[model samples]
Target: MLKRIKPGQARLGMFIEAIEGSWADHPFWRNQFRLDRAKDVERLKSSHATAVIIDTDKGVDVALPIAMTERSSPHPRENLSLKRALRTIEQSKPLITEMFENARIGGTIPVSHAAQAVEHIAACMQDSGKALIEVTRLKARDEYTFLHSIAVSGLVVHLARAVGLDEKMIRDLGMGGLLHDIGKMRVPLKVLNKSAPLNDVEMGQVRLHPSHGYQLLAKQGDVPRVVLDICLHHHERIDGSGYPNGLFDKQISIAVRITSICDVYDALTSARAYKKAWNPRDAARLMLEQEGQFDRRLLMQLFHSLRL
Candidate 1:
């Protein structure tokens, strides 16, 4: 999915050098990097190339080119425009360090480097059709709306595959998951990233997000009702203890129930200011201990389905 790029993230009129599918220690990637640096890597950087990523193969070259606009590259031959690449990056990331577990084997990732990583993932997804986007989700927190979208998408896709949803439903679930937290974009970053617990007033503002998200998507009218319902009802619970609408067992769709479990699990497992991630076993134990807070059957399904 595409999103609007924020300020300072775009680097126009640059020589963006992109490589694909060459693993480290592999002769091809090592040789290519050596040859390129020996020749003109400094020149490429000086040209202000937007982002560069070296991967394992060469048939795919999905650069968010300086002049393309299409988001879905469709086939390998098409060029991915920079705007679309920025859109995908903004739509699918928190930042490099948060998204991937071992992003920097040994050093700090500054703001500029983090931004470059987001751009690279977007370009790769648009260019290569690879969901290496998953790598970014490895250690993410609730940093931005896009981070939430990516997390929810992964969880939904994982659950959909386990439950045997067909291709269309699975895709729909992905789109829904991607936008489930769109409303949060309107919330203040200070509030969303609050260093301390929220008081009653701030908590109320947070609670309004689902209905707000529903309204935003409702205005667009492109997403189906099921997807919209998932956005709104994902916060609802099986035992009637959730918000936006405290939908109970018979009140919610099975899909919505499953999504809630997945969403909760992903959020909990992800590192955030308010909480640290629990180990997979510990997280499952906590969920199971909650009992009526979640749908028993679906929680069981989700617990067993985790890639961990």
Candidate 2:
């Protein structure tokens, strides 16, 4: 059994299964470990993690009655919301991993599975919008690619609803966001995960993902046109500065526009191997400063919708 306890409650004998925060907020390189060193416990307590998940079966357990109750006692409703959000993300992992892996190997794209994942994400957003978004923002480095798709999917749904799009279109946009970076599967891991700045060749290869993803989906023969459009054009900026075709504002559809904002916002707020995650406020502000990179009206709408 796993129990969440305050970081302060973490003792030397506990087995830390996970820490409840982004990778940038924790002091340790890995999430799971047996807390054997006194200094390590102190380090964890001083870190920005609000809670630590300990596997009670592996090491000494905290007093169950007190630890469990106190963990949820402060705000049971909020805790429940977080748990639902976590559950939704966990359910999405295998579905998404399989979907992307299949795409990488020339297998058919599972539209039904993708739609089901979108529905799960959409339902989670409706039930716990803030909690779901907050949970999506906390991505582990190794899980970044998978979690990023989930995060962008949720963000697009949220923004689409905020803009009052019809239900079908909203779901299509969700699907688009979910698979927007499918082309990245074609990029080599060495290029994708490079810690240092990329050379021109690497940068060019990275930029090809939109077209790569578009071709992958286009070959599927049954993907929605809207989804295919988003996969190809999410990178295209309003001012024709983006990749592939460098489409101008008029050529971009509203769905793609919404997706672009969400895509960039999630990317900005997510921790990458080459950069620390920017806080929401800073990320939004920086996006605003980048002239013509996104649709200003929709971007503002997104910021307002998210209350950032």
Candidate 3:
């Protein structure tokens, strides 16, 4: 027999048939497992997983007193479970990857291609905001450009909704994130793939990508202003420390602020050839410590959305 119960209701001996949150948020590599350790139980309890599915026959049956409550996430809006959201992201990656590949060859980033990918992500966000953003962190080191675009777009969708932006504005923000790093496609693979620290000249070359990407998108003549802002300014820090442009304080728009947080968070947690991946929890903490580097409210909203 299988049953669903709140994460808090789970007991020590129960078999966790499926966790209801993103895999990035949990420690387990496999979804189905027996809860044999006290720490595992505690981790699940503290996780963003609102509910967990367990096999009564495979482990201990639910305790009588705890089994009587409703079997759903505390926030019922999370109708799309983590597993389903991950599947959606996986299916959407290749479409967006092809778009990036085209851009690398002097191809224009068709708004149509971006709309299809953002539509799919918006659909996933309608299911579960947390899963849509968190699950995309699971990607190969070589896929940073392709996957990072998708990840930031998804995060923008979540942030846009959280802040009550209208549908049109939200869509524009999503499009910007999907194409934010399109300029990197113009950067030489040798510099982008270097496994060691870059010299100043190399770093200078690397920083030109935003402008290069912006110029490419601008030529398309159909890119939205919000999308253009993100492409050119996602790297621009609030304190004037970022590259391509030293736009500081009010110069950075909310769209750029939201995208930047998602952008940095994904970059930190992702496994790059140059450095090992930081744990999601550690990445969130480090971002909080960077004063004047990010918008505080949007930064808090990113963590709150991820339940980290």
Highest TM-score model number: 2
Which pairs clash (backbone N, Cα, C closer than 3 Å) in model 2?
Answer: none
The per-residue C-alpha lDDT of model 2 at residue 202 equals 99
Q: What total of clashing residue pairs does each candidate reach? A: 15, 0, 0
Candidate 2 per-residue lDDT over residues 14-81, each given as its tens digit: 68899988778888988788865446766887799978999866665553211333453436666567
TM-score, per-candidate, Cα-based: 0.58, 0.79, 0.72
Q: State residue 204's C-alpha deviation in candidate 3, in Å.
A: 1.2
How do the residues 95-202 of candidate 3 rate in per-residue lDDT, one tens digit apiece?
Answer: 777778877898866678888888888887786555655445544445667767877888888888898899999999999989999888888899998989999988
Instruction: Please provide, for model 1 over 268-304, each residue's C-alpha lDDT reduced to its tens digit, 9 standing for 90 to 100.
Output: 7555667765665788888889967888877777767
Ranking by TM-score: 2, 3, 1
* Model 2 alpha-carbon drift over 4 Å, by segment: 1-72
Give the whole-model CA lDDT for all candidates, comma-separated. Answer: 0.52, 0.82, 0.77
Residue 290, candidate 2: C-alpha displacement in angstroms: 1.6
